[model samples]
Target: MSPVVVLVGPPGAGKTTVARRIATRLGLTFRDTDLDVEELTGTSVQDIFVEHGEQHFRALEEQAVATALAEHDGVLALGGGAVLSDASRALLREHRVVFLDTGMAAAVARVGLNGNRPLLLGNVRSQMKGLMDHRRPLYAEVARHTVLTDDLDAAGVVDEVLRLIEQDRA
Candidate 1:
């Protein structure tokens, strides 16, 4: 099955939240690969990263994304670094990928320096900056559309994504 909309972005770019709205608007189901990974492993992502490290987490993420992309013909939200995997990027090529972009300030405001995030432990802003710098190109490469979410609420993001998809169809 092919997803109607596959959202890819940085950690706090509102992919999960906006995906839900887009799914509802389009009468499609919503699936977050991150949540799926958690459900499959019966553990939080933070714990996975802390205990087994990023490589292990990425492996799980790869499996989760692959399964979702294959089985779900709806809206799928991938983890921030899920696109880093070459296999995931290849899978994304067959679907309508939307990159949800947000500025560092807005992302920080949304996510904060919480302990729940394993990557932003020492310095949130710096970590986010580095992630953005590295992953921006990858996101652009895989995404058919990019929606800026810094100034938009969840509803606004959903509207923009819908408009972009409609434009692409035309």
Candidate 2:
């Protein structure tokens, strides 16, 4: 099976929050690859990165994303950097992908330079800016629909995604 809704975006774009709400509204299950990776390792995403390193964490993330895409028939949320994998991006193309586009300012504000984020540990703003800028094209490449989450609350983003799903169905 494949996901009915797949969320792709940078950190703080509300992929997890928006995907969960959309799943509930659609009466479907919600799954996040980050959570899946954590469950697999019995640790947090940050811990995985800290312990085994980014490359290791990314390898695990790619596998988790692959499995979830093949097996899940629900709303799926990808880790921020999941699209970095060419394999993952290719897999995403066959699904209903939505890009939660967010500006650097809004993203930084939402994330708040949290310690929980492994990649943004050094300088959250600059790191986030770079990450977002680098990933924007990848996200757009895989997503059939795009919603700028910078100006919208979770509910508003959810509404837009729902509308896109509905429109896609029609």
Candidate 3:
């Protein structure tokens, strides 16, 4: 199997951007769970939540994660809360997981005032901070490597991920 590299992080942590770069550098197919979910459902994530609620959206998110994990060769960027699901976390354990860690200020700035993020719609700063507190430990537990993204640009983060992949191979 071509090794799978899974990127997990909170919103605005540059997971998708870095995952895309890393996939390109490694000659792997790129897949984002959120994108897949949106594509499969034919609706924006915000619309899903507003129409069907979080529980419904999460069911779709879980399915997306499962499909991504089953792929033999690809870079997968998971939704921010995907790790919260036990089934999703279990599937991720089969891959090389990377946590793109960033601070609350950075996350807030990056995510901005996006109401599309259901969890981050109101008082996003505080919501983000709370998410970080809850999710950071889970990210650490699942990740084979952690890249601090506070100061790194997307390219720099991709470089770090590449180095880690090389190290693992060595």
Task: List, in order, the clash count of every candidate structure.
Answer: 0, 0, 0
Show the colliding residue pairs in model 3: none
TM per prediction: 0.96, 0.98, 0.95
Top candidate, metric lDDT = 2
Give the per-residue lDDT of model 1 (tens digit) for 22-72. 989999999999999899989999999989999999999999999999999
Global Cα lDDT for candidate 1? 0.91
Better of 2 and 3 by lDDT: 2
Residue clash pairs of candidate 1 = none
Top-TM-score candidate index? 2
Give the local distance difference test score of model 2. 0.94
C-alpha RMSD by candidate, in order? 1.0, 0.7, 1.2
Q: What TM-score would candidate 2 get against the native?
A: 0.98
Model 1 regions lying over 4 Å from their true place:
none
